[model samples]
Target: MDEKTGEVLGRVVVTQRVGWCADLVSTMARSLISEHWNTSDVGMLASGEDAEGRALPSNAWMALRRLGWGASAPEGVKVNDRIVRMAQEQAGRTLRSAQWRAELTTGVLTSWPADPAKRTADEWVNVRAAVPGGQHLPSSVIKSRTQQIASFARANGRVPADPFELEGAPGVARMLLLSACDGQQATIECREDDPSRVVLRLQLPVRPDPR
Candidate 1:
């Protein structure tokens, strides 16, 4: 309740159909992420190149298509174009997310802790300083990177030389990231006729935006 305006502030409970949409989106996102969030595909997407050395399209999905690594819907599931757009949208975001991990990996590799199990204060400072935004990165992220390096050393003879050699890419959460967009890429609505079913709208640019 707001005393100043005499207006009550409360939560409005929408139908559970919203929850269904969320689950549906999550399932779809996971499939797309699994298909595209890998080293070979993401590496090509990042480089924007094809096997023949020709430049790829600016659009992530088009770049993927040029490289013959584009994602596809499940077998026998005829999804509409909007769904494909959502997959493209999510793939772009996932590739961008990999960049941070790539930087973090390089920082950790360059300023590796003397002991992978633990880091001294100086080692921690050095690593954080080496990374672009390491100071703001969570300690857990660094720790996970350390653990991966240590594991690699245990299996191989030596520590990894770089992020690419260390690992393909870090795993990211499977999400549609509707909040990140301006409602153009995706939108949600409840169907008055069928309260149990909600409508999720997805619209993507036919061509990549020229920025």
Candidate 2:
């Protein structure tokens, strides 16, 4: 189950319909961890614990627009849904008040369903924000789920390391930019792309060591 990708989940996340379920699950998990959830219906998340036998929350379909969880794509930063879920789950628990950046992100919607009400049926976007009081992402930051990062590193043949101890995307970027070898070197560049956006670039020399 670990090595084989989450097929049903993958289809759900990459598509529109089932994405809200993931968000709800992620949100519920975070709330439990954060001790902020107010509903007694949390048992809905228990394994085989369907109290109402309903697939998910009635408002899940309205998650993005209703909640303003998404914004137009090119106008916003791109992100991965997988990490967004982790961000939600990690939120106030693993992540403290000062852990993430001040700014929050919403999904970058590239396409829309013909029927707005059918939004939950199938949609795609980059993760950027969360529920009213859910986790705020790290600043100038992005976070990746362990599975996503590990799988990519395995295929690429190098595991990154960071001396900065920065968390989320910046941390990953730092690790990737630095070399395991004593003298190996890399270059990183940062610049403002626009009034609201910034760009970060990393250049590393190819190395024989796969660390």
- Which candidate gets the maximum lDDT versus the true structure? 1
Q: Tens digit of lDDT per residue, candidate 2, span 127-173?
A: 33331222354322333322333444466664323211122322110
Candidate lDDT scores, in order, read 0.63, 0.28
The segments of candidate 1 whose C-alpha lies over 4 angstroms from its true place after superposition are: 1-69, 118-122, 136-141, 160-211
For TM-score, the strongest prediction is 1
lDDT of 1 at 171: 47
The true-versus-predicted C-alpha distance at residue 23 of model 1, in Å, is 8.4
- TM-score for all models, in order of appearance: 0.50, 0.17
lDDT at position 110, candidate 2:
18
